[model samples]
Target: MKRWWIGTTAALMLIAAGCAGGTDAKSGTNRHDRHTSGQAMPAFVEQSTIPHVREAYAFAEANADQLQYIPCYCGCGSLGHESVKSCFIAGKKANGQLEYNVHGSGCEICVNVVMDAKKGIEAGKTLQEVRQQIEQKYGPQLSPTNTPAPPEGK
Candidate 1:
């Protein structure tokens, strides 16, 4: 059916958009197709073919500052990850470039946590609400990262 084909095509396009992409720090044309920010994706992320892995990595990098307040519940605490952000970002370099956490590129629990946070935010939840929701959802069965609660009052 034509409708089926169109729906399938749209889904494929969405999947393709979430794929790991190469970057060109110079030329504009024929550059990174998924994200044209001119910054290369970490090799670890680029090695993944899973759309969610790539999508979550991109989201984690772009929202690093905010994610610091969101806890990741996957026992990453034992790994010294202080917050959800630490699952994806090890730290910044002297020049301000993010040092990617290779663990992020492979961990489904980390990616799912980030994705859930994003969905909550997009659905009009406040940061506090989002944090609480994630905690309530995962706290019972998993160990959470050392992320602190959102700064008191806003």
Candidate 2:
């Protein structure tokens, strides 16, 4: 009976650790934050788990004005993602504070686009120049109405 009890306790501890790992340490904010329209936004995953996601989020937050005009070719538009920035920022509050969207942490395309934009901006490229480069590379492969046909069936 003592052995069984110890095993059960260990299992419980493992489960608890898994649950705790999902929370964001920096914000410590609950996932049910209200949107401008008073709707509940989805919970965001912790960005620390993914390489470059945190940096991408930071760039998106810092350059929102320029990124707002840059289009995303990841087909997230159906999710109301107007631009690459929208994948990281859900909306702004009345006081101009940003409500971060956790979606970018899970999206490779979003992270790549943000990183590319950051590089371009650092190299002194104008917003229009960055937009042109991104569109030229990703526009043709956009998932919306442009995904390539699958290769012959396995």
Best by lDDT: 1
Tens digit of per-residue lDDT, candidate 2, span 12-62 = 999988666454445664433333433333445342456777677767777
TM-score between model 1 and native: 0.74
Per-residue lDDT of candidate 1, residues 1-154 (tens digit):
9999999999998877755443444643334433323456676787875558777777787777779999988788999988888988788789876677888777888888999998987898888998999988889999888787777663
**Model 1 error, position 124 (Å):** 2.0
Worst 10 residues of 2 by lDDT: 145-154
Q: Which one wins on TM-score?
A: 1
Per-model TM values vs. the true structure:
0.74, 0.61
